[model samples]
Target chain A: MSLLGVENVTKRFGGLLAVDHVSFSVPEGAVFGLIGPNGAGKTTVFNLITGNYELDSGSVSFAGANITGKPTHRIVAMGIARTFQTIRLFSDMSVLENVLAGRHCRMRSGPVSAMLRLKWQRKEEREAIGKALAELRFVGLAAQAENPARNLSYGNQRLLEIARALASDPRLIILDEPAGGMNELETAALVNLIGRIRDRGITVLLIEHDMSLVMKACEQLVVLEYGKKIAEDEPDAVKQDPLVIEAYLGSGDEDF
Target chain B: MKPDADNIRKGAYAAVAVLWILAPLYLDKYWTDVLNNVAIYAALGLSLNIILGYGGMFHMGHAAFFAIGAYTTAIVNTAWGVPVLWLMPFAGIAAGVFAVAVARPIIHLRGDYLLIVTIGMVEIVRIALVNNVFGITGGANGIFGISSPSIFGRQINGVVAPGHYFYLLTVFLGATIILFSLLEHSRFGRALKFTCSDEVAATGSGINAAGYKLAAFVIGAVWAGMTGTLYAAKIGFISPESFSFWESVIMFMIVILGGSGSIPGVLLGAILIIGLPELFQGLQQYRLLIFGIVLVVMMIFRPQGILPPAPRKYPVDKLEKQEVSL
Candidate 1:
């Protein structure tokens, strides 16, 4: 059985169907890519999978449990975490605090424990801090930990967003445009970082525009066009698929 | 980054507390009264900080909660003869509950709409207090002959004297500061901060943004209510006229001056606000004019208030730390 499965999932916004009967499965420990041009409903799939929006029809099963209509936080608690296309670090907070917030779902202490600063809670906090620092260091941001997230350069901010998501300790991580706004050099670094994340035994579902990065990094690829899945297969094979190529070229041609 | 020196400063605060607690013994009644006023104002400033600073609520009706607390305690302790100390928390609960109810609906509105609603609410509460119901509240005459709080069937005002009241004030102020400090550092507090910074981002992070805002509002109301109770106890009387829109504005000013979200900044702002006026009693007529000008200038120059929130630091791992060095 697949580790995370989206079977016949559909999402409609008012009169428009944003995701139409999308069905796919992510095999355990697989590095999968979802790619589409603008308005092709790539993000809608991420939204549906992460429970940011409810599926109009069908279901999402993670670790063999349905999480279709669960709240985003509940999904996160169930070991599914995601980063945004727009890096949403807690900008006012320090880099470390932003990641610590991701640990919210994992925390065992109640308000009373935090308020009283109990020994057990303090110990747990120390451990959590150590982990957050480790994740930051892994993302090459350990020294920038004291800086406000807003002060970080764009590339570092993107990395910080990933570190924050990792702090939640999820089994499956979804990165939405992880290389958005990065130059070739930065994209190379992100490709390596995403691989490191997957090597830690976590499954990855990546939505990206950088075809080169996706083709090189993703073992499997799903091509989406106009709210429908046109093809799913090995990256090389999918790149050669006529229907997938047509969808990309067709949308661009039709726009004119 | 080096460890924050602020952490060490907190230790020094404890030593300062020890000294302040003992200094009242050497003070005369006049000085004791001034110190007492400071404690009361500090509590008031702390209360405002919870709402405007930490909660990011633009409340113009905080004085409504303050009025409710003061009246509840005064009415209960005077007419029904409840002991003064017992009256405080009960009054706080009454005001807190009122705030919770009011905030449920009002908090839905954002920005200027929320501000107008709060302003209207304060006006309504104040007018109701002034008008009274069937003469029970004495209307404009206000409740009179209120007694000082008592302990063990003896008047605390007499037994404890002004010096003991200072102790009580210290205890209350200390506890309030400690409680708010813990709240600012908690997960819930972080949720509130996220909401204040970006509501949409906070919601996307799986924080119940609306719920956190409501929590901050209610908590701020409770602080105001508790301070109101203290204010009534210290003065031994409260008039509806005293708890007006200006009173709420003054509270907002205190919070704004102290750097909207900084605890120590709020306390310092309160001292300057309350202290500056007292020290310049000679310029009493022009005092408010000068205060308003100073406030405007401060707003223009330091809009973040006395101490804007500083960026929080996270621990760095060995690799990233080395990367920075390179």
Candidate 2:
């Protein structure tokens, strides 16, 4: 069953149509890939789904409810959490603190409870710390939980971002270029993590340029070209699609 | 940091705190007065640190809330004859409510825009006091003849003397430090810090960036407002001049100079900022010039502050225990 549905979605910037009437749905518990050439509005599409950008036209529904024009945090609370194309960890904060922040939406303790250290508040905080550390262990950065996030290597930072997103306890996790700048070993680990995330019953929607990883990990794929959806099918079928080939390789008319 | 180093740092903090609570006995009355001022400024600095330091907001109009609190105390006390200490909660509420109203429209602005707006807010508040808005402000001459705070029939004699007010001020400062420290370690504090460091990433992680920003602003305002009551009670008179834009600047500098989010840094900053010029009173006209040079030197030597916030440590061993309990 589809958990997130994007219908006739559109976004524009001044005169440029960043995402033009694109539509897609992410199935529940499936690893979905959003693939397109550079400047194909793949990131823009991600932004629209996560409510980072307002849709110029169209509606997005999650969990059987329309969620168009909601604020980014609200969208995240509705179980759609995403990472940036560029890593954006809270560099000065501890790695553990970074993950705890992801648990922000999940926890209900307020400023008063926090200040007074009320009975339930203390219990909640202790639990949050435990879960935050658990996420760090999941990302294999448990030993560095006390270190500043800036001290992490680039690959570890990517994992940290994932762990942070997962801390929000989202139903659908959106990863943008998670494998970018990763070594072969890191990519393999990410693929394994994606499978693990699915096993946890969370839907995965990712934007990727890594064809090998995408074909290997993603159950289905959506391809875009110049702000329009060109193809949507299984990874094997998408690889053989003529329109996707033209969009990624070159326009076939040029014969280069 | 190593556990031993953390323990040593914590021990040093305890020693300083003990010394601080006991210092009034040894110091002369004049120096005791200086200590009172230091305590008050330290509390105010900690208040602003929530917004400017933890929340990464550029708030320089904190004096507006301070002025509101002082005025609230003056008006309520002068009219109803209520005790000065009794009005602190009222002043904090007034400041907090006003902060919500003021910060609501402008909280979406990022960086320098927010800074400029807050600066304008302080000026507007000061001008309103000077103009005697609502006629209760007593115009440019300011409110006077305010009552001293009393505790269970024991008056501290805060009017025109530091005497027992030193103890009173220390108690206030101690409460402020403890409460603010609790807040700093709280979930609210973590979310605020994350939002400040990176709003986009924070929001994506399901944290409400604008709401937390406004909350930090209001929390800071509420604390500053309570401190205002203390200031008024200490002086027995409050004028528009006391809550000027310069006052706000000094509070901002206190947070930045000490270490934005470090409580100890703010206390040290309050000490140096209030105590240094008084100790170097012989500088006279060149005091500000020397102050500027000192600030420049500080910027070059310790940009992260002399005491930056340390990384938080959690007991990983607890995870095993937590699951078993569950």
Candidate 3:
């Protein structure tokens, strides 16, 4: 059974087609990868699925519900959470507070309740703090929970983003370039982290440039080129696709 | 939260409480009146801090809401012979509803553009009042003979005793601080800060960026309106000149000068912005000039204000920790 399905999704930016008729589905609890060359629109697909951009055509569904054109927050509420290509931590806020902010969607207490410190709000707040800290502990940043988020190291910042996304209590988590600025060791740790996340019965949709990490971490892969889905297969089979090779290494037809 | 930090914060709170309660006793009538005035601005500053500080919306037209609130209280009190205190909620609602209408279309504009529009918003409101759009407003002369708020059958008026007004304003300020502090730590506040920092990331994280911004704008206006009610009752008069563009500027400066998101910073900001010139009254000719230079120097030296909000603290010790997998 699939948890998230993108059917013939398309997105255009004025004159340019950012994502074109891309279609794929992630099986429940599987690690799915969306990979292509830099401009192949992997991030755009993530944006479209997450409702950051309205699909120019087609539709997206999660958990058997058509969520096409829903607002980003609504998409998130329906068990989809994502990280940016560039790390977007709430800098100047404490690391724990950053995770708690992610937990904002899960908590239901409104402004009046919050201001009054109503019994229900306090209960939710206490539970939220516990969950946020647990997320930090999961990401190995519980010790730095009180420090400013921007004070985290590059690798830790990526981990922080994952923790933040997880704090939203999403069943499907999308990560865009989760290992973008990571070194080899950090990438190795991230691969292990993704495996841990998968072990916890959550589905992962990843957009990564690191081929080695993609192949090692993602069980299934969808390859894109020029906004078109060129390949979809197991990691081993995806490596053997000629179209993917040409897209990555070039076809030797264009003038450099 | 660490024990030591907690202790320090508690001590600071107690110290502020003592000072707030004891100040009017030691001060003369003029100084007490100054204290009351500063307290009003402090409340206004904290209210605007929601939009400008946490929401990161550059709203220079806060006085528009303040004006709406003051006028609401004044017009209603005069027309119906109702107690000003009874009209507080209406004043807040009027400003809040107006804020929603005006802010909805323009909330998406960024930084300087939003600032310019808000500036225009206040001017439009001021012009409306000056022209007596509804005829309830007394035009250029503005509304007068507004009643003082009575508390517990005892009249709370600046004329009978500035101390009574001081206590009333301080008590309200205390409530605002308490409620706002709780709000600062709440999910909504966190969401607003997130939206302010990065709308794209915040939206991606399941935050309604436009909704949160609009909510902050309205909440700020509601509080400002209530503060305006207090202002009307204290003065027993309202005028177009009172809620001017410069008043908005001063409120804006209070938030920034004290530390935009920090409550104590705003209080300190109100003191300096409203009290410094009075303190330097002996330099009658050069007081305004000296004040400007001091503010310029302060801004240059401490761009973040006197006390930017400390990072939020959470109880991590209570969480049952597990080892991070290598």
Candidate 4:
């Protein structure tokens, strides 16, 4: 069964339909890619799925459970985690602390228990730290765990964000332009990290402008243009499709 | 070298603790009383830090909770003869409940908008108390005949001497510091910090941002309310003038001047804001001017506070130098 299903989703901002009748499904443990040009409503689709914006129509389901219009945090707790298109690390916090915060939904201890430091709360806290550390290690950020997030280089900051998202123990993780500011080497490392993330049996849904990374990592691809799905198929087929090519290069066949 | 540094720090803490304990014995009654006021202000500052510092809420109405607590204790004790100490927790609860009710709708307002709304809230509370809404507040004349607080069968009489009250205040201040320190490192505290840093990111991480903000508001309110109980018990009286908007402003200043989110910073801030004014009583006319100048100079030179909060750290296993260095 598909782990995520966005059926007939439509969103409008005044007169402009930001996302118009978009439908797609992401199978479990698969690496899926959504690619489009600037203002193609790619990020808007992410916002709608993550409940950052109210959809004008249609519904989203995760793990066969209807999750449309749920609060963003609640949707996250139900096993869907996402990163922002722009990196949003807790700038004042240490890298490990940022990851530890992502473990908040999985932990049960509240203020009272935390204040008193009950045995179970302490145990949970220790385990959370352990898991967060493991995530940092997975992303090769274990050494920089104590550094303030803002002090990390841009590429490392992006990795820190991914580490934070992975700490939530979600079944599905969405990457919104994770390679936005990355250079060639950094993008190559990010591709390897995404492949490793997929090998852990977590479904990956990515929105990227990096055709190289998307074509290399994603099992399937969805092409969007001007708030509509222009093509959906295997990367090879989608890349060759005239509609996808036209969407990217325009009718005049200019280089894109 | 690390062990030596640790020992020096420990020794410093011991010396400070010893000096605090011996203060009342060596000092005059007036000085001792002033020190006690410093402790009270420190507690209040720490309370406000939880909201304004950690939660990143622009809270300028903490005195309302303090007033609620004072009134709760005053009314409960005067009417039912309940000891002020016994009703202290009730005072905290009252303030906390009041905070939940008042902050629920307006907590979503950010920055200056929230600041304005909180300013209005404090005014509303003060006006309510002045008007003696239910006749229980005793109007602007205030309530009196309040008995002294007895802890473990020993009465703490303010008139007798400052020694016992000094010990009492110290105990309360120590407890507040310890509790706040523990909370500052707790999961809940981290949640509040994350919410403050980035509400959207915190929500994306599955943190209930609004819920944590509300928790911080109520916790700060409860602490302020408890401090109010202490203030009432110490003074044996409370008027609308005591919990004025000026008092709220002073509390806010204490957090900002002493690093907003730093516990030690807040304590130092309290001493400077509350204690220094008393020490400079000779320059009465220029008191406000000096304070304003000091604040401006401080803002210009060291805006983060005299003792800025240190970056939070966690224990790591053998720091490895990775291939791709930042």
Candidate 5:
């Protein structure tokens, strides 16, 4: 059985169809990639999966449970976490607190216990903080943990967003445009990070415009055009798929 | 230095509590009356802070809760001869309950609409208190002969005088500050701040926005009601006239000037808004003008108020590896 599955998902904004009858299933521990041209509804797919946008029609199942119409937080708690294309960190919050906010779903202390800082709550807080620190370290951001999230460099901010999502201990992680703007060295580092995430047994579905990074990091790739999946296959195969090559490389009528 | 801040804060609270408790032993009658008013206003300002500062609910109808508490205490005490002390909590709870009921739907409105609704709520409450002539409410003239309850085996009515009441008010105010301080630091407090800063993000993170918002409304209402009890006892009289639009404005000014979301800032704001007017009563009408100028200057120069939220820090030692995309 697929670990995460979407069947015939269709999203519409008025007369415009953002994603039309798109269906895909990701097996547990697979590093999957969703790629497209600029207007290919890639981020829209992420939104549909993460409950950030309501689906006009379709169904989403995670871990064999129907999650269609579930609120974002509930979806997150159900072991699916996502990072945004824009990197939405709590700007005024501390680096650690941003992670703690994600860990909010994991906390089990009663209000009264939290108030009195009972032994259990204190221990839990310390443990959560430790976990947050570990996640930050996992993303190579330990040195900047004490600073406000907004003050971090743009790349660190993106890393912080990923760390925050990871802190939720998701069964499946969706990263939207994880490598939208990065140099060669940074893309290489992201390839390693994606590998580490998969090694930890978390499935990843990432959207990317950077073909090199996506092709290197993703074992399987799906190509979308005008809100429809044009092709899906192994990276090497998809690269040569006539539809993908024609749609993405622009029919080779011009530059190499 | 690690322990010094906590110690100083505790010391400040302790010193204030002691001074107020022992004040009747030394202060003259005139000073006692002034102190009583200060206590009442301080309590009112603090309660307003819970809503505006901590909960991020901007309420201009807080004085309405104060009016409700005062009226509840007055009616219960006068009609049934119940001790004012026993009636205080009941009044506060009653006011809180009313706030929750009315605000559940009204709080959905934001900014100008919220301001209008709250202003309307206060006016309606005031009118009800005054127009209910057939009912137990004394109307425009107000409730009188309302007596204070006994404490420590002595009837604390007109006998020990306003000075004793001043002491009681101080103790009540101290307890409130401590209670509010704890509430602010709790998960509830954090949740409220999150909701205030970004409701969408907060709700997306799994917080029940409606629940937190309603809780803030009710908690702030209860605080307002408690302050009313203090006012009723301190003055031994309350006309509908006392709880007015201007009073609500005064409370809002205190919270904003002090800095919303900061406990110490609210207290400091309360002192300035309440104490400054009293100290400059000789300035009379011009005193209000001066207060307005001060508020305007503060808003223009230091919009974050006397104390902004302290920045939170990340633990730098936790970074594992750097991945630069560019």
Candidate 6:
């Protein structure tokens, strides 16, 4: 009944074993968090789930359909959208244009209809623009819609990426280090945005190094270390788990 | 003040249109013919722009499509006696079909790899024509004495006046520009731009990157084929030499030097690269050297070209003021 179910997923890059037997289930409308140290394969898990990489073993099911080894774009169209760890805006495009590009999956007008500007195409385009604007407004970027994406500040660019993901009308949205580069204020804003995104009845899954944002926003957490799951529990319990602490601070007598 | 600026712009555009319409009357027959060539090249440049400029594909074999279109016209006209104008659309369809067939297998190749493969494709097509693969290509010498095209049952031979061909080319060029302008602003065009900017991000947005790339190639090929038909009709002859590898190179240069993704820029590029050499006929031997120098200088100075594409804008004045005050 879960929206996304990963069963014994394993991926190896030669002998590295980037992800080893990772399993988790994300319930519908839940904000799930994946936290890990550098090279802990959190991003690799995301890549596997999004079909960006082929899994060595195990299956992934989204919305009750097996999506194992499906192409990235097809997986995205099947109600799952994601942002990158590093920002990947169509930099030369305007902010609104970037969001409109995300709406590409939802629309069906091809080259001939587009070239001829059929009535239905125009109507669909107008609706798409309206929807894109609504998403930009959701992320507080409606005013900067006409500005080129590259011209926006780093924080605003991150928000634009979120808006773009939202425009795809996905059932579940994944955020990969959505708060990678931000001050306290920007991080706080991102947390609020994530909360608003979840409030819209869309499930949220995020990978974050910002402990405060992750702990505040995620309803449940999964911890990984050395490509293996260390702990999976509520935020308060995961924060206090001995394995999670050891993974973050190392096994030595290091300061908390 | 805005209205005055608009008026000035309108006036300038009107003056240019008037000059273009009156050119054949004032210019000599030789110069009129050169203008005709410019129009043809402009159309060809626009065609290549759809792939190289918008789709961000390195298509170094566009001349193959051109040859396909020209040969289809030549063969169909000679055998079936179809009116050259009526056959133009079929020529475009033939070239588009050929493009889909050839580009399907190699559309996955990107950047310089695709470039190398396309260069080989052009050679393959050229050699096929030279060998007269179908016997209908007329071998290396090509077909000759093709009938002139007629609009509304009026023949446009242009043998004596040259104005007839000039008008026809201008109409073709104008129509091409209009059609391309519509496409450049549409959803399909935006998809091509997104694919060009970042293929991975575009795919993540659910764009079939390969499909859009193929569409761009086919559209570009269709345009090139139509231009080839026009070229054959104007010359009343066809030859393997007309659609050479160098011809593809010139079309690529026209798009790049004019600023890729800019419609007006490509037209200007066609005029400069095609028209300038003709104007400097007195310095005939140094033409290639001069072109090289000019290209190098352009690259050093205005690399984005004479008219780089401006940012796209939408008319959403009401929504513009509704920021959340974040």
- Write model 1 residue lDDT over B1-326, tens digit each, in one string: 45477766667667767767876778777667777777777787787776777668788788998888888878887888887778877888888899889999888788789889999999988888889965666677667656666657666461237787777788889888887777777776677787777665566555667777887777777767777777777667678887899887877788888788887778777777876788889998999999989989998998998766555433344323333210
Give the proportion of true interface contacts each model preserves, from 0 to 1.
Answer: 0.27, 0.78, 0.68, 0.67, 0.23, 0.58
Compared with the true structure, what per-residue lDDT tens digits does model 5 show for residues A1-256?
A: 5899989999998898889999999989999999999988999988888787999999999999999998887898889888878777777777877777667778766445754667887667666677788888889987677777789877778788788888888888888888766667877898999999999999999899889988899999889999998898999999889899788778866755
The residue-level lDDT of candidate 6 at A78 comes to 97
lDDT for B143 (candidate 2): 91
Q: Residue A16 CA error for candidate 1 (Å)?
A: 4.5
**Model 1, residue B99: C-alpha shift (Å):** 2.7
Superposed model 1: Cα runs more than 4 Å off: A7-16, A54-59, A251-256, B1-31, B133-138, B151-154, B158-162, B310-326
- Candidate number with the higher lDDT (3 or 6): 3
lDDT of 3 at A49: 91
Top-scoring candidate (DockQ):
2
Overall lDDT per candidate, in order of appearance: 0.80, 0.90, 0.91, 0.90, 0.79, 0.90
Over A1-256, each residue of candidate 2 has an lDDT whose tens digit, in order, gives 8999999999989999988889999899999999998999999999999888889999999999999999989988889888889999999888999998888888988788887889999888888888888777777898888899999999899999999998888899999999999999999999999999888888999999999999988999999899999999999899888888888888757844
lDDT of 6 by residue, B163-240 (tens): 889998888888888888878888899999999999989988788888999999999999999988988988788899
- The segments of candidate 2 whose C-alpha lies over 4 angstroms from its true place after superposition are B1-3, B159-161, B320-326
Q: Give the alpha carbon lDDT tens digit for every residue of A144-180 in model 3.
A: 9999989899989989999999999889999999998
The TM-score obtained by model 6 is 0.96
Candidate 1 whole-model C-alpha lDDT, 0 to 1 = 0.80
Docking class of predicted structure 2: medium
Candidate 5: Cα lDDT at B242: 91
Question: Which residue ranges in model 4 land beyond 4 Å of their true spot?
Answer: A253-256, B2-11, B318-326
lDDT of candidate 2 over B65-109, digit per residue (tens):
989998999999998999989999999999999999999999988
Question: What TM-scores result for chain A when each predicted structure is judged separately against the true chain A?
Answer: 0.96, 0.98, 0.97, 0.97, 0.96, 0.97
